[model samples]
Target: MDKLAELKQGLEETWHSLGEGWRQLRDRASEALTRFTPVNRSRNSLEDAHSPPALASNWGLLAGDLYEDGEQIIIRLEVPGMVKDDLDLEVRGDVLIVRGEKRVEQERGHGRYRVRQCTFGSFRRSFALPAPVIAEKAKARCGNGVLRIELPKEARARGRRIEVRSG
Candidate 1:
């Protein structure tokens, strides 16, 4: 029975080695897949949270939402880590343009960073209004890292009914 016992022990060790090899293969495959996958800024919020900043590109991505409430179109953007003075807003024709620059400050005495994810760069986001707005009367406010832009729709764009006249 000595030979049989030795054979059984050898088989157990081989099984464990095979299991480890499978685990390593799975981990390597998962990392390769993640590296190749393209991240969609609009759909994947969690990925954006952990993703490193787009340093290779000149322009950084800006996330925002546009909606219409009553007679006004409200646009809210997430512009964290920036001051109001760094932003510029303009209305040209039917397009509302927002331009801003985010500067990243690094102290000289600070220790090395293992992971830097905060994005810093110039970004421009332009939105086309659904209806004509009074450009001169537009109002914008930046508070708590959120930029709110309110544009009032033109009087003509508001639903108006014309009386039917019998010929």
Candidate 2:
């Protein structure tokens, strides 16, 4: 009877120790996973964080391709559903400024709609020309909702490249 009591006491103590260890491991794992997860916030959290949110509001316009031709810098803007009259282009010194507004129609009797993607309001995009471009003679055209600006370099400002060979 004494040996059986001793064995039972030992087994009970071992099981209690294992249960405590498992509880500690579960709590530690929960804490580690919670720390690794990212916190969620409102949709406009990023907008609220910025002091001046004008640029952040119209960030989609700034994302585009900028290419340079031989003597002209061509800028292609993707302005869908916009006409030539709606856009304003300006060239001040070395800077080329493009401003436009996109309008969406809102009709009555329309209930709540899911907004998976959103694009709105006015946008202003500015680019700097590498060399002096003729602003007065510069021409811009819009076709298929794509605005192309041709900034031709001044005749005197165009440099002729001379290849130099090492001695």
Candidate 3:
């Protein structure tokens, strides 16, 4: 009886140690992947190829949300470290493009100056309009480095209903 109990306790200890070792290995692997993945720089052609036209910028472009609400569409972008004057909004034909540049202050110290992360660049995002919108009536507001655009639906073309005539 004594030997059997000792063997059981020994097996349990080994199982717990193995579990801890496995967890450590998994954590190290996760850390390595996080370190290797490159951080977003700006709206690059490679990364923005899959996204919509309005979501091409490198900064807020990746973090913005596009919502459609029946008669109106709203686009809210999270653009930190940028001023309202630095952004330019343009609409050409059926496409809307948002462009902006974010500048970072230079470091004063002159020692080693190693930069581990970089989050500054110019970005341009274009969105294809599903339906015609009132470009002239569009309104934009910028507050706390976030740009919000409200596009009102064109009254002339709001899913028109046609009557069926019998021949």
Candidate 4:
């Protein structure tokens, strides 16, 4: 009877340990899924007030819009929390390369981080122009956390009219 009771106690302890292990695994998996899932926030959401601007990833992809207006091609990029000095742009052939770095600033006191969604690192985005452009005459400006680049299109050659000759 004594041996049987000891065996039962050992089995109970083993079951509890297994239960605790399973709980830890479930919690870790839950946290990982939450961290990786994308969350869409409204433009005027209060969450945006305290948290930094959301980036696509650590090496985030720069988001921009490219359009043409008559003889000029315009490109606008959203680069919040960045200064003009942090960005670099270059036009190589028909590709426009934009590179920049985002630095993380810690204002709050050091403590355990519950959630970390903000990203900070170097990012580069390249765009191929739809039409030939005069890269030398391009103009760029940054204002209100947006970068605007204006590229003048190359003049198209006009078709020449030929006079008909008598055979």
Candidate 5:
């Protein structure tokens, strides 16, 4: 009876520990992530290649940062294994929407993946702007697997600079 009781208690403790860990992770990440799905990009003549069968674990995250700098909002997002042509960007209301596809580049024919850690799929990430922006004047540049977007502020959205003088 004692052995059975101890085993049950140990199992309960382990279960609770795992649950707590998962809860903490969810609490930290549940709001920061956006939906990611697979997109099939049509191959050009230069990119003609075969793709491996999709596995169950064919999903990943696109991490990014959005901050205000002086008179503009700058957003930088991690987009490895992708190009400028692969991405699509747009802004509606106060939200900035970015869509892109990361395709699997086949280096050789008839090869098996011994280790597939990197994710290849389509993903969209959105950010809420702190202030209204001049969407027409926005500038975007991409390099080194990072997408940088500079959104200029609208005329009314730019805050007035005030100087305090000691009386």
Candidate 6:
């Protein structure tokens, strides 16, 4: 085989791997509550674990749940190692926006890191609400590595048909 053809084949294979990884991540986004960072083969093993790689994607699942129960909409997000002050929340139109930065805590004593699996940085996740909600009446709380929010669904207007008479 020619050298150019060999290089093209290798590039195509790499792209396929990247596409599959991204597809799996997106497909399981709603159900999985774990974070993932695909190792960049091009970079040396000594590089930073948090470096932005393939497709300029950072790492953080920020998994959460959104559901409606009767008159309210409930949202729960897994945000371990954080307090209420570390996160931010907002309601925009039919979407709920959650933003936060996860900073790595410093240890008391000096020690060299042997293993690192955590991804830290700013992340924003937006969820579309199934029903309208009253943003002013929303209440949220963060505790036990989880953030829970409840928004009272807006009262939907009832439908009424007007009778028409021929003149």
- Write down the TM-score of every candidate: 0.59, 0.56, 0.55, 0.57, 0.67, 0.61
| Superior by lDDT: candidate 3 or candidate 5 | 5
Q: Is candidate 4 or candidate 6 better by lDDT?
A: 6
CA lDDT, candidate 5, residue 21: 100
lDDT: worst 10-residue window of model 5: 43-52
Q: Candidate 4: TM-score?
A: 0.57
- Relative to the unseen true structure, what is the C-alpha lDDT of residue 140 in candidate 5, on a scale of 0 to 100? 94
Q: Which runs in model 3 stand beyond 4 Å of their true positions?
A: 1-61, 160-167
List the candidates ranked by lDDT, beginning with the highest: 5, 6, 1, 4, 2, 3
Candidate 2 lDDT by residue in tens digits, 37-113:
11222334322332233332322322444688678888887777788987899999898888776654332343433
lDDT of each: 0.69, 0.65, 0.64, 0.69, 0.77, 0.73
- The order by descending TM-score is 5, 6, 1, 4, 2, 3
**Best TM-score goes to which candidate?**
5
Candidate No. with top lDDT: 5
Better of 1 and 6 by lDDT: 6
> Compared with the true structure, what per-residue lDDT tens digits does model 1 show for residues 1-167?
99999999999999999999999977655422211122333423212333444422333345677898658889998787787898899988888888777665443433444454455555667788888888888899999999999999899877687899999
Candidate 5 achieves a global lDDT of: 0.77
lDDT (Cα, 0-100) at 26 in candidate 2: 70
What are the clash counts of all predictions, listed in order?
0, 0, 6, 0, 0, 0
Candidate 2: C-alpha lDDT: 0.65
lDDT of 5 by residue, 1-167 (tens): 99999999999999999999999987756544555554654443113234344432355666788889668999998888788999999999999999888776645656555555566667777889999999999999889999999999886888788899999
TM-score of 5: 0.67
Among all windows of ten consecutive residues in candidate 3, which has the lowest summed lDDT? 30-39
Pairs clashing within candidate 5: none
Compared with the true structure, what per-residue lDDT tens digits does model 3 show for residues 1-167? 99999999999999999999999977655422211122344434223324343322223223566677668778887777777887899877777788776664334343432332434456676777777788888889889978898888787656767899999
